[model samples]
Target chain A: MYGKKVKLRIFFFSIIFLAILLTTFLILKSLEENVVYFISPSDVKVLPELSKKKIRIGGMVKKDSIETNAKEILFIITDYKSEIKVSFSGSIPNLFAEEKGVVAEGFLKDRNYFTAKKILAKHDENYMPPEVKKALESKK
Target chain B: MFNIFSPSKIFSITSRATKYVFAIFILIISVGLIEALFLSPKDYIQSDSVRIMYVHVPAAWISLGIFSLIALLSISILIFKNKTFSLIAKSLAPSGFIFSIIALVTGSIWGKPTWGTWWAWDARITSMLILGLFYLMYIVAWRVISPNNANKVTSIIAIIGVVNIPVIKFSVDWWSTLHQPSSINILSKSTIHHSMLVPLIIMTAAFALFSLLIFLMKYNTELIKIKNKGLDRL
Candidate 1:
């Protein structure tokens, strides 16, 4: 009787254990739908489907391309080969400058313009990405 | 006179009592989810995105909490040869990993529109990445090591890795960089509104309880496994 009780307890707990794992996996998979992505300027150009979706385009803000009107700033974002225009009506951070990597979050109304709600600089001196460097060099 | 509640017995009440405990856990978690999801008013600045706070913050807390628990338990097992302690440490690991992943994923969702970047390598974020990596390594270690050899080896790793937790946590503020300082806690300037705060509190409490209950159940299973296999001596 004692042995049977022990076996039953193990059986019950194992079911619970498997249930916990299954629930976690299902929740995680559902959450996966919301995970968004950031695309390079070049990557954005090729994927026609993404043109209608809310997306982020990240690259350097071209020097001399930034224009301002009533504290709202307008600038051109580039992946070296193609340029996308971004306009933002907010105070710019100190790191926000031309020739630095910036990710502009908004949607493309057309293929050429990107209206931005937020902008952030990709700043990490030690962790310079190889691809961005390659992109820069190819332009030269 | 010598019932299940005897001094030596360990909460071995009738199965009906255990059912009640399960019901209480379910009730608390349900209330917590509702409060976190519906009752809490949006942040004045962040609005609905801030709702992510309910799930993200508690998961992050549990991730760190479990790491500490594992580190402490590892220490106890090493210093005292306390078999129960090592078992507890091992049992708590997956819960920690789950919450850590939750924190990372929820953080990304909250950041998508707000931060403008899906992910960043800022101090808090990078350290969090490391924390997540450490979690993976810890799990892999359990799988790779022999059962008899696992305890002492993992203990050393756990103790050494504890230092990284503080580094991951403090790196953001120290750098004067991006990624805002801890919100929903000491560094935040604005107080959370009562409606949102209530659910935040409830969900956090529920998450902690869930983690605890899971830990207990897992711990019990490990004990049984060891006993059945006569590996308790190892």
Candidate 2:
């Protein structure tokens, strides 16, 4: 029931669609190398290797562990069970506080040390996204 | 299925529904705003900044949902050669684009307080930005291209753009991003406390009602335009 013109048009559009898909695939493949993986302080302790690639670590800032110096701020991030020391030399976000959840993007200097390139102050500790809260509860 | 109604009948039905939809939208918004802004308890961590979720999440959801609907309708258009499908797609684009922009703007506002920056190239944000761009492209195709060919071309874009839906949905799991993962799961009970979830759910319903009201009005206008074209041909 279809006309020859419609068939020709479909074929023509198919070629264009394939070209777009191929371009998107290539770009994502290249970007995959640069994407950072997020981990908790506890996850870092169990890593098989000291990854040189940048990664993100998220956890609550340990109370009483924050210290400030002339050009740097130091804090300890804890998953309650494990803690890792973090140091940064940049202006911190206003929301950054002790006992608050935060995610830091940086390279792991060693098993015990993390030098954060940027600090992401997470929302209220009670504000666990439903998905995250569910995931956390499921793990428990 | 939609063809069962004459153009005049469609207009009358939509006009009658508009009153109830508008009232519902108003009721929901008033309740949602009060709950979101004043009644809901401040997040233990993010504080009041968590309120932005009421608007931001719904806008993002509507944008994605509209595009997916357009894609589905486009499939019907190709299969059935129905003009009504294209017209409905046309009707949905402006609001879709508007909600997409709102989502981005609200997201940036929300991000500034929590993420330490207004914008980041995180996977979720990047993919959402692309989604907004695709919405603009779809809208532009309808406006600038001739009517004869616009339906075919825009439908093609809609279908192809479906690829981004899964990407946006899975971005949090697929990449490490500053944006938090989706919380309101459909498969299971939401982890959000009932007090907060009530307002969020209400706001989502309000937004959906508003979208439907806009869509109905636009659909009526489109049908009139098509009728005019028929008259001109005769």
Candidate 3:
């Protein structure tokens, strides 16, 4: 049998642990919308109504979907389920390229159109040498 | 086992161990640096920029590991009323705080070139920043609170802080963060190539040894303080 002191300590520890767990859960749940860094094209497409507030759209740069002129750059971001057109007049990260992951931040003009004030690149977790990458591509 | 926790005994053992830990730490860290900086292959996409992973990832892992350790020790102190455990936790915290800062700074530096931003309020990043704050608070609690009450106060802070560790680990999965999902998976195959993984593992071991060295030095000093106060037992 456990001593009275041990029982009391265990009860106290459990109470504190559970209280912290519940509080963290509620806090994270309340901040769910904000914690999501960006929404995909599919999620944006199904929005009940469009607002003037700025939002970010994240996906891959649809292969060969880029068009550039002296003034602005145009590209399509696709999540494989849906696609959105993005236009930006700012400098892009070095990692931004066709068939690479990207996130664009700005306002939504329509379900299909996005005007981006900033373009941030996203990369996958894979790491290898350039030669190994080339060899993998050649094998494919 | 109880005798080992005596201040005089721990002081003598740690003083001897510190020298060996330092020598091994220097040797391993030198090897780790060479492997991470020169021997490892560059990323196919990010190229040389990926080298920053050598420092950033290990610092993050160490900080998280150390915080978890401190929490466990705090729990032990609460249940057992062990002053030795409290002293150990106190000594371990500063290195954990330093490593968390290192992780945040290195991550921010890496983000600028790769993510196109210096900072983002994404789930993973925000949780990591909160972790750094928690470490700061824990260290400050030790200093601000009176010695008689410092143990109870710091233990509560540490236990509460541990809730964030799981959140930090799962943030990438739970939300759409700018940070990528972890490449090192214990339950599955890792995505990183062996060449890069080798250097990462070595660097992690080296960092762990360095933290141990720091912990020993801090702990020995605390023990010496107790000895000077003419206490044989903590």
Candidate 4:
């Protein structure tokens, strides 16, 4: 009976192990199942016949060329190699300035501007304190 | 055989000391975070989000460090059948899992402000998630296997599974993704000033010590279980 009890204890723990693994799987699948991988115009060298899948493009806002309409805001991003125009319909970030490194996610409707659902700013590697960050913000 | 204060007691003595160590660690972490967040000088550009570095970088560092320690603990058990080593591995698993959780949560919080979206399937995050899952499995392995065989089986798994850690680190560079490479690892071009790096280093050290303290406490509990088993046999 003692041996049996020990074995029973181990069996119960095995179920716990399965439960944690299942939880991890559910969480990761939820995170990845929806994200669309897009590419930049300069990086979009292949220009594959991608018509069905959604994608994202990343680069910089071309200098002094941001155009805004009531419907959309359009700008070009460059990887220092080539540039691609991106049209975003959402509230653009203040840091989404001209000639800074950026990454945007969305689908391309034409060769002109890729419609962006999301835009990300790639700053320097380190985090700055708020006062210094405010200084930079004030300059902008 | 159970000499409470024998030479074997060094391990036990250190286990008790971990509580003091961890308390001091928490103090250091809070001081470091406070300095970095409110008191320290800010960046030339990024304002508030720059403060995310205090939390994000340390959590990320701990996630990987825990796994490497697990591998080391596992190897010591498998190769030498070291009893204390297995105890250490079992205790380390939950903390590693916690650190991974911290890294993911802090990263997501940082992401919302900088990336516009709350989440991204970037290379580094993906690998970090995988590392977290691996940690869960390692802990589960410890719980399921027989105490005797758990040591052997988990040790083997830890040694074999370590291959994934490096793969997770380099996956960003290998595959094009939104996540960038090691910030400090890059030359002085991307270097953070000493003022910023000091707080980060202190936080990292504090976190490591804190994890070790928890590990010692956990080990003491498991040692009790082992001692009880011997009593049962008698």
Most accurate candidate by DockQ:
3
Candidate 1 vs candidate 4: which has greater lDDT? 4
- Where does the lowest 10-residue lDDT sum fall in candidate 4 chain A? A31-40
Off by over 4 Å in 1: A1-118, A121-140, B1-21, B185-191, B231-234
Per-residue lDDT of model 3, residues B19-136, tens digit only: 9999999999999999999999899999899999999999999999999999999997887788999999999998889999999999999999998999988998889999899999
Q: Enumerate the candidates' DockQ scores in order.
A: 0.04, 0.28, 0.87, 0.18
Least accurate 10 contiguous residues by lDDT in model 3 chain B: B1-10
Global lDDT of each candidate: 0.68, 0.82, 0.92, 0.70
Candidate order, DockQ descending: 3, 2, 4, 1
Weakest lDDT window of 10 consecutive positions for candidate 1 chain A: A123-132
Question: How does each model score on TM-score?
Answer: 0.60, 0.80, 0.98, 0.79
Report the lDDT tens digits of candidate 1 across residue range A1-140. 33565566547545754665566447535743332225666766776564566677777889899899986889999979988888888755545777876777788876777888778864432211234445657999
lDDT of 3 at A100: 91
Best by TM-score: 3
For candidate 3, lDDT tens digit of each residue in A91-136? 9999999999899999999999999999999978788888889999
Model 3 CAPRI rating: high
When 2 and 4 are scored with TM-score, the better candidate is 2
- The clash count for each model shown is 2, 6, 0, 9
True contacts kept of each: 0.04, 0.28, 0.86, 0.26
Instruction: Give candidate 4 misplaced runs (Cα > 4 Å).
Output: A1-38, A126-140, B1-7, B186-190, B231-234
The DockQ-based CAPRI class assigned to model 2 is acceptable
